[model samples]
Target: MTQAASSAADRRALLRLARQRLRARVRRPNAGDAITLALPAVLVAGALWSGSAASVPELATRGDAAALGMLLAAAVAFLSYGMLFRAADDPFLRRLGVESRAVYAERAARLLAAGLALVVVLAAYAARAGRIPDQLLPIALVAVLTAWGSGAAATTLAGRAMVTRSPGSGWGCLTVGMWDREVAAAAPLVYAPLIPLLSGGAAGAAAFGTGWPGVGVSLAVALVLARLGARWWEAAIPRFGPQLLEMAFAPPPPAGVGELSVGRGLARLLPRAAAAVWARDGVVTARRFAWATRIVWPVAIVTLALLARRGTDPGTRGWVALAALSVWMLQMVALVGLGRYERGGRRWLDRSLGITPLQRVLGRWAFGWGASLWLGVPLALAWGWWTDAGPGWPWVFVGAGTAAVGAIASVTAAGWR
Candidate 1:
């Protein structure tokens, strides 16, 4: 085939793959998935619709515009990084004879397209809110350029972290000696463009009293980052591509001390059959990095409590904190409940064990409930004491009930699989 024909064919193949993946995701919606997806859309839609003509002028001020640009850039960086690093399609694509650079390009193109679409929506909203056309143009341009730059930087960082096998370096340490050291390092460089974008936006607001200066700065940053990421991707693929594949197919790492002890110690406190199942799930939690990272949720809950305390009356503050904690508990049903099953050979082992469905359900429920209380109890008490409210001990029962529901849902889902 001619070079041109080959290039066209590759484009068609990638597009087909993208379409199929999108279709599969669309077809597999469950109640939890629908709610999880809808909540974000609802929040964004609510924000957009809540503002009025009266608020538009103040909202379109330079500082607010700059903050908006920074916020968009930050969101793009985080989403792109997570999507690129956690994806498991590298090995599958490699097997299909897809070039690594082409795979990265395809993914980056999709992200850039999504970013541009978001820019258009925001710009339209600004125009509808009576912002001057001149101001809207520059703000839109800056947003598009910033998103492009942020996505490229994130992709490059994710790629580098994926290829890194040394546990002592970068975020490889997060692997905690389990699985491939695939966690992207929380490197500040991935977000370096935010500084320039923010500065440019502020400078544009000050100098031109418009967003024009930001457009040029954003474009330059985007071009440089894109070119650099492209070069690094091409060079790294030949050297580390095989290693990347090996990492994907690698067996689960040996259990650490925490995994062993946590399960066994918890088992001692439960009934015999349920204890066995609970111990197993507990070990699974330890092995999964998702659970460890969820520590952030509790931290966020505390931060919200502290922030609430500043302005509100003690009664209101206490209620607000309690409400936030309750929401967190409810969310745990989806986050922890659905993730109880093991994958691959271990899944087969689970089936082969002479454990009854009732025992499995009871065991998993106990595990989830225990996990919830372990995190939630301390948080509730701290909030109560700090706010001079009475002990929030009743939440323990509420947490247990929610956790049991999550456990049932998870086990039922696993059975279907």
Candidate 2:
């Protein structure tokens, strides 16, 4: 790029930043934003404080730290969620006649500090009044972590916006405006999957019969996952919107049968799957929601693996894999819904314009199967390796077959009323 072009791009970015800040300051505040931003934190906090009061006493008498540990764990989760919940900077900040960045920065810091001080005072008094609760450690840790996440949400947004304005060749715009909504929407669901694991994780694992030892091993594995995941989330959060957008707008491969090479660095993407994976479905399957669904499988498989480690024999683990069909079935349904949006709702609208459903289900299964494995193959291999279950054996056959069947159900549902 020439010096003129580089200077123009920089100028555009700075102007855009300034314009956004101005708009945020001038925009009117509304009740909905306030409700949306604060409600989850309130509910989580209420659950942590009230639920712990009752459970902690019972567990305290028995010296069972698990109950308290669980409560604290929950408290921390709510706290973390609250922290990560990105509240839109009030557009009305400019109305207060203190709109410049320097002033805004100073004010934001002071407000955050004051809020923390007030919370600390209130919490200390509440604990004292409640007779000095026995298990506040977890609750406190979780709450602090949550606040940190919340505090960083804006910084994350700013960093993301900066990246957007300077997207190098082929990189697209990732404006704070567009992603601010998407991340805000998706953030709530992050805890949705985990909540099931927290409360029902044991029951799900017990389906394998490894007992607490199984659960322990599952957690040990999850911690490592959590660390890796945290690192990935930090990198992905900023550019995810633009990257996701590009994935959507980029033209898909032709329906050709030959001369395709995925060459991204995965054994599963070997010619066998790649050749069969049609470009259209391949791109659809390769997108965000599809990958998210694929990731969900590990969460499920890990729970089952814990059971296997505890006492779920290899055969029983296979059985658990079969039962996993239910989750796959449901997730494929989600994919179908996402697929509609991904395709810009053209197909659905066409159907509405009087296109009839063809009876034969020929490509439906293949589409779902290809897509499921498109996401699942790597996951299955990872599962096999992690559980020491002899790689390439079950993952290659049983896992693939099960995923295929589930995709069939999901695609089939697309045709139904």
Candidate 3:
């Protein structure tokens, strides 16, 4: 075979292998798991859709369409970045004599396919609504392409950052230490369009224009970024491939001083049995990078609230604050299962330790509530204060209520397990 043909075959083979691995990992969901996961997601999506439908008339304008497109792009980019890192098997592929470029190509193809599927779904929805302008359709398509390319490049850079021990400062160091280098690297990409969308100026309008010229420029930029990402992947693989593999397979490190201190503080605040469970859950969550990264959802909600205050009404701003707190609560509740179910032999070990079902349930609930309160209070207050709302005292009560709901829901779900 010619070199080009040989390369094509390699990519095809990699794609097939990736699909097989995905299928192998994804077990058929039980009814309880289906309801637990699907119900909340469906409700949230329905609420968001209703709100969006109410504003469909406003989407006729170029600025509104641009803003919406940017927001969609940001969402796709962030999800793609997270998914890439979470499921990366680059080192393993490298060991199989598959080139890094091939791996990157396969991943990029999958991301683009997913982004295009989203575009199709949104396009169909907009068509049914009959409010979206014809000109904005291309803009939406370009936005997805841009997002996919940006996400791929960001993920590559983030992977590179993870294996590097270079000293960093500020939030970069802090987030990287938490195994959130993907978030740190992708933050700028995620926020670039958001800033303009929130600020709503002439420049912002021009940058996110829904014209064909803008779409063409965006497509070109996306292609360039994808090219750069491929080059970066090829370069980094030779240098950092082994380190990435090692990090992927390495055992979780022991809990740090911060975790221990948090546990000690919770111990003093709670009953002995519950505190032990709370402390154990905290440590377990901290040690698992994937679980730790779920904190991003709440943080993203808060960030949206902060940005949304510029043109939003007081009532809307209040709701945004409430949503931020509520999401934090829900995020914690979702994590309860991750702590108990993901690790092998964990349930057996818990039973061996003489931890009763009641204690386990109470501890999980307390941990979820406490963690929600710890993160949500400050975020809600900040959102309220920044939005010129009162000290956000009302949101604290709202958060507490939601946290209780989440805690109860978590315990009930655990019971089903």
Candidate 4:
């Protein structure tokens, strides 16, 4: 084949591969996953509708902001949830009829396509609602493109970092570590939704217009980074072998001792009896980098609340609902990680120490609730100060506290099982 023909053939092959993979994914989704994926859209729509008390321009602005948030959340979910690749499939595909590079190419292409789709969906939604002014349309497209490209690049790097630094552990331990990294990386992207605030307002379209060159530069840099990541993976796979690949994608086993650790700290900060547990939890959290997520999660919620305040009319019930939901989601993540640590790493020690089940449960609650309040109390106070709901900030904090307790109660109860 001529060089041009060969390149054309390769393009065709990659497109074919990507299509087949996408079709396979479509077939695999059942009701549960489908419903879960749709939840964000529903929540966004509901929030927008509830805030209809605002003026048309205000509603439009809020809708646009929410759309931006939804896109960021989707990107974060893509990066953090699972193994970066089906690395195990390389040998099988090679034996059958595929090069490993093609796999990476297909994955990258799919990710890029998803980013483009986000742009299209947001544009269509805005156009349909007529919320975004015509003059701002081009700027909106540029902004979304910039965010998507930069986000994709960040995710690729994060995945590469995790895989490169991944230690040799059993399937279960490795999987847990991967999960931890996902949560940590995703916590930062929470701020991405607030990128729109930088534009200021409809009047600020000129601001974004001036930044167009920067956006283009970011997109180019992202493409280069993504390519580098794929190249790195393509080179790494051959040495990994089928066994290691299998272990990488394998279902995680029950959580265990590897999930917990004791770092340098006071095991005597609390009651003499519970000091060890408290110290271990504190040290493990501080040293392991997991504590960062606790801070990030709350910060993200507060950012969202502030954004809502800007987008919606004061005293809108939707704003409160949105804040409450953010807290619930943050607490859910904390509970899951904390629960796993307790069950896998600390349970045996607790039993031996004659730590009553109540004490154990309370300890876990204390750990999670404190983490929640670190950001939650200030978030509640801010929501009150910013929104028409200021007078009811007391009630808002009460509700926030209640939700935190509920999350802990649920997680602790699950540990009881």
Candidate 5:
């Protein structure tokens, strides 16, 4: 075939693959599945709306638009993580029987299109909120540009991480989370919408007053990082396919730990049976620690650092700090609860071993909480010191205690389900 014809054929194949994937994703879920996916969002939104009357005063007094912008950026970063890093698995690439920079260039083009769509939506919202045409246009343009840059930077960070760490490693999940959090904390304004909301001004003022040059610098950095990531990705692609296949085909590694006399040693501190159960659960918790620990603390620390450096209104600062602490605690609990469900299949075995449901639940809770404490102690100390809260020991105790109770409650609820 001629070069032009060959290229046309390849484009057709890619378009067809894209269509298939879209159809697969759009297939309707069952009623129950749809409800399961959506009920939490509904409930949370409903609760917020219901409480808005009561919350208005507090919210007005302590709201931080900048902080909210950072959170939105973090959410987008998470949403795009898979898109940015794992194009090797693209069905179109397999069909093409080719691996080249052109594939990624195509992917980047698609992302740009999507980013433009997002910019358009955001511009409409700004206009509706009374932004003049001049402000709206510049804001839209900046939002798209900044998003492109942020996404490229995220991709580069993931690629660099892939080069340094195996995804299957124990800390791999944590490392990825920390990177996301750090990026969000560091470049919160990249999302652009946050600027006007916080500034309560036209786009030009927000853009310049909040240091718009940073956005251009980020774009420059992203260009350099993209080059580096592409080089690393090219080297890594050859090994990627086999590694995935091996993982898919491999059997589960056996329950890899021996029964412990350690449980007996701790029996004096707890019920003998509970201690034994806790020890076994401890092994599992150690092996499959939650990704949340990696995420929450790093994000919280970075946020605190930002607050200290930027110096928000004291009321806003305190509220933000408390909110961060709450998030960290809630995340720890949710992770523990999820882990219990993950091991639900083993409940029968515990029953067979004469362990009551309550004991099994508590044991898992204990292990989760204990592991969280080990992680939280250092964080609490850091937070306390950062806050200049005298007698930081109270913060340490509060952190550990809150984590323990929350985790226990989560595990118990999961068991009941």
Candidate 6:
């Protein structure tokens, strides 16, 4: 019991240290740094606001208004966190637990694991309990993107706070109510979004007892519940709090240490081994970590669903343009592939040739395009399904072909370099 108590005390001491470090990093910013961080957000908001101003559509009813309002709120919270995090550059949050080098490689891996779990849980919940929106496919898309955005907010805030922060002083956004510091950082825009979301939610809950008055009231209540629920989702910073979700599980065995020997048959695949090696890592480095890729098709699918539901006349040219751009963005992962390989390149290189700059460049393209095709094929199929263009496999084949074209174009251009 004495030993256990001592351990607990040590843990608390360590956490406090990390928290102090994070706070310090957030403090003491220079004027230039402050302005540089602030500018991009201002430009984004101005552009979006300007767009909204140009066409003030009547909020079809209370529900439309609620979602639109929440979107703005989500946007503000996201943007402010981004600005603050960028300025923070705090890495002090890491406490003196695990060795630093192992922690770095595992961070990405651990995040991916958590995200996969989160996605599976949320989908199961939605499938079982929630009344997904009528524009469900698109709604799913938006939800996916929103989840990614939520992550962006968390990382930016925690990462920037890194300078003064200990290695692991992560953010628990549910604790945001206490963070008047961050919430107040971008007041002009922040307030605009948050007020409507919060107050409207409070108002909606009061009306939930309205008892099936109409579809309108049902959705309004749902919005209110969502807003309240979101407020409670404070993530536990792994290193500081309970330490449940470390970026990695057990540290991977080091080079020349515990590698599994491949049998003779598996050795034949060696030529293609480099491609196989980086597949998952490459997709991950490409922002699939945020589940941003999942958002694209769901949005496209939802949009297509809505269009079909309304029986709207579709323009072929518009769709072709949309398809081309969608494929392009999906393929952007190729450019970022090198980053993942480089992160853990030492271990990979032991069994292979060392990565020359050119090989690194080529490998990145290969991984990016390979994963893009993985995503793009389905998106194209869904488009065909929705539009009734042809049978499913043909569209899938077409998408695969188009994505190949994009891969070649991307890798060939100086852009991938």
> Per model, how many backbone clashes are there?
0, 6, 0, 1, 0, 27
Candidate 5: worst 10 consecutive residues by lDDT? Answer: 53-62
Q: Find the candidate with the highest lDDT and give its number.
A: 3
* TM-score of each model, in listed order: 0.64, 0.33, 0.68, 0.47, 0.48, 0.36
Give the C-alpha lDDT of model 6.
0.39
Q: For residues 1-417, what per-residue lDDT tens digits would candidate 1 score against the true structure?
A: 764466457667887888887676568855444444555477657757764555443435767666565555555654565444345666666677775556666766776776676666666566566664456556655755666665676466556554653655554344343342333343333344454355435433442344577578767877777667766666656545576556435356555554443336656776676787777776666455343435435554664566445523675665555654555454454434344334223445556876666777778777767776654576556555655556667656666776676666666555523
Q: Identify the runs in model 2 with alpha carbons over 4 angstroms from their true place.
A: 1-248, 251-283, 287-334, 339-345, 348-366, 369-417
Q: Candidate 4: deviation at residue 407, Å?
A: 7.9
Clashing residue pairs in candidate 2 (N, C-alpha, C atoms within 3 angstroms): 24-91, 76-142, 79-146, 83-149, 83-150, 210-310
Colliding residue pairs in candidate 1: none
The whole-model lDDT of each prediction reads 0.58, 0.40, 0.59, 0.48, 0.47, 0.39
Candidate 6 residue lDDT tens string, 1-417: 464464455445544654575466458543222333344346544544444322432333556544543443343333433332221112433445432222221332232333333334333434444333333222222332333333333443343243334554534443444334433333332333344344433332333323234334434443443333222222213332223223213444346643333223333343444344345334344332333344355555554455355322456525543654564554453333223323343434523555343444444444444455554555555555555544445544454454444344433332222
Off by over 4 Å in 4: 1-31, 44-98, 148-229, 236-293, 296-327, 333-417
Q: What is the lDDT of residue 230 in candidate 4?
A: 61
Evaluated at residue 120, the lDDT of candidate 5 is: 52
Clashing pairs in 3: none
Residue range 1-417, candidate 2, lDDT tens digits: 764465455445444665586466447523222233344357546644564333333324322333333333343333332333222232232243222332223333333343344335435545644644433333333332233223233333433333444434222332223333334333433433244224322322232323345444434443443333334344644454344444345444447633344434342343333323333344555443444445455555564455446422676555545545545554554545433343443446435644333311223344455545633565465456545455534444543564454343333434332
| lDDT rank order | 3, 1, 4, 5, 2, 6
After TM-score superposition, the amount by which residue 1's alpha carbon in candidate 3 deviates from its true location, in angstroms, is: 5.5
RMSD of each: 6.6, 15.9, 6.3, 10.8, 9.7, 16.1
Tens digit of per-residue lDDT, candidate 4, span 1-417: 664465456657868865786576568853332333444567656655544323323323445544443443355334421233534355776575455455555656665565555555555555556565443444444444444444444444543444455464233332433345544433323333233233222212332434446446545654675566566656554554353454434344345633444322433344544444544544454444344344455455655566455724644456545655565465555454555546554656667778765655455454545555555555555555666554534544553465455445434533553
The local distance difference test score of model 2 is 0.40
What TM-score does structure 6 among the candidates reach?
A: 0.36
